[model samples]
Target chain A: MSTAPTTEKGRRTRARIVDAAAELFYERGVSATGLGDVIAASGTGKGQLYHFFTDKGDLVSAVIRHQVEGTLAPQRELGLHRLADLQEWARQAVLQHERSPVMRCPLGSLVVELSNRNADAASALEAGFAQWRELMSGWIAQLQRRGEARTDLPADDLADSILAAYQGGLVLARSRGDLRPLETALAMAIEGIGSRRAPAGRHRAHG
Target chain B: MSTAPTTEKGRRTRARIVDAAAELFYERGVSATGLGDVIAASGTGKGQLYHFFTDKGDLVSAVIRHQVEGTLAPQRELGLHRLADLQEWARQAVLQHERSPVMRCPLGSLVVELSNRNADAASALEAGFAQWRELMSGWIAQLQRRGEARTDLPADDLADSILAAYQGGLVLARSRGDLRPLETALAMAIEGIGSRRAPAGRHRAHG
Candidate 1:
């Protein structure tokens, strides 16, 4: 468990530690990273680290949450409300990937190694993915209501499919050392989601 | 580079080592698994191991090939010629995951950690994925030619998308400890591939 930092300075220090730890964890697997390394990377003293997290698990939980926020920030900023929004989002994903040194999702990379190793970490990842998926499902549902996305399938299923494509596309793109896999995967998924034809007898009242 | 086994016994010993190394690499990880562990697990002497493989990199290369064969065996066995075959293959993939202790693609899980750390392993992985994609593309192309699959996109692009869904779905399923994500991603992808409407003014003459 993590202790809440009451003071503003304390919160900043804790955030700094979490950010450092998240980078180390993402670059190197969680198993390979130690508390000492995190302390050195964060430029924080041992006492400061102990004051915030009780153990590595607690720190990992914090890192997972931090990663979730980072992963969702762009999506929240750009929005996912319309079909065009989704296409633009896909384009942005490819662009962001192109700018990064490695082709991996910040959250999904952590999931690959930590999901089966730690119980707390696994649940934290599950919750993080749920939050991400829920946000997407909301947009998909909105689009479905507006007749801009598929309605035959539940919005959540479509949301999950899109997320899967992103994760898988990243993996393939990294493996092939090319952006086409990621680009093609996301394009295909968004195309499928937007391909819903208007119902045969229930035509839209307006464009 | 791996040496060719001149005799039946040498072939058996080499295969055993590769199988043990693959399992260890998957269950643990490539960075964590050492030569000693592989040797102990394979019940082969250190000298015998070195006789076949020049180093851990050589072993990993062989394991990559072994894993590719194992991964493609199912597709080869079931075939990927028609839309039904593709659907059945997806269903089988889900069923296979249901039977496993962990939700991961054998080849993909390897690609996650090894893609960046080792050049030889990375290239081997690239070749493995290329081979896998080629097989799927061939099947998809056949379907497209028969007018049973989408022709608007290149067959290889469709193959990559489907492969991405499988990989991304596996990660999500493992994170959530549920099969629904994998099932949904694959179902949506296949549905998209088969949704190609006959080209305008080109109707099939046969039923």
Candidate 2:
């Protein structure tokens, strides 16, 4: 029902709508947020909204994609090559949670609501999570090659485990309105990585 | 607006309404489900529904309590005195996910939808998580006294970390429609608990 933007102005218009929608969805939830809310929040006309999105489902998918990009952009930038980077990643998450009013993962929050109900949004989220796992796995693989991590466990599994610790930690943190659960969970997960490890003789020598 | 049930029949009627609401909330989310949906799902009259619940918010709090009891019932029954018991806990979770139509923790699924928006529901959920964590920590403390777990780590942190792995792993598993992440994350978390432990020499000799 909608077409991709052809011009810079069109792209900007669509971006505005999606950004506004993403905020509303994160705060109120996709089920509770209406198109009228998005249009009002974005300061865009109904015509502009319809021109860019076919329906609420379409808009939800776009928001999911946007959230995926936002989540991955910073993670992709991180080297994730050393234990210190992994430690810093956990530290930053706890710090961010402390500063924020509500502790919800922009993407993780969407999964429970959309995964079973919305196919398009679920696929977008699945792809995003896969990319996240692959990036972390790549970093772990590199560390394994340098004898900096445990070679006994597959990098893919290790990455997934770390990801699980983070996701589960955030849920507990949100429920309790505290950071201790997230902090302890991430710390233990990072510590688990160093368990039964190959000595990082070569990697340690450089630093 | 609703009063406590003074009779057995009143208790059953209230429980029926709460059960119906919990299912609809889990499947469709709290925002999308209405009181009418509960009435239809429960085959109860409006008068009965209103008699049991002051409003949807009251019903949501009741559902949270129901879910907490459901989540903790099985956990309390487990002795959780050894590593094998921990492994079994993880295995049962993965197996349950495989068997169920949707992958979600009964209580966890509610946290994101209600944690920020509803104060009463938030308090109920926070109390449930705290109770759950305390139960897990109690088990870990018992293990520590028996030299079955790492004493270097606090029982509370270990419990929280394991909980995080279970929760985060479930989110990833639900997103991926696969069990590997949940399985790996939990396995690694349990493995971490036994890391650098005091030897269970006495228990081992008895075995």
The top-ranked prediction according to TM-score is 2
Worst 10 residues of 2 chain B by lDDT: B198-207
Query: Candidate 1 clashing pairs?
Result: none
Q: Model 2: per-residue lDDT, tens digit, A1-207?
A: 356999999999999999999999988888889999999999999999999999998998899889988888888888787888889988987897788867888888898777475788888889989988998899888877876777778899989988888889999999988888898888888777763522233223221
Predictions in order: lDDT: 0.86, 0.85
Q: Write the per-residue lDDT of candidate 2 for residues B173-195, one digit (tens) a residue.
A: 98998888899999999988763
| Chain B TM-score of predicted candidate 2 relative to the true chain B | 0.91
CAPRI verdict on model 2? Answer: medium
In model 1, what is the error at residue B142, expressed in angstroms?
0.3
True contacts kept of each: 0.59, 0.72
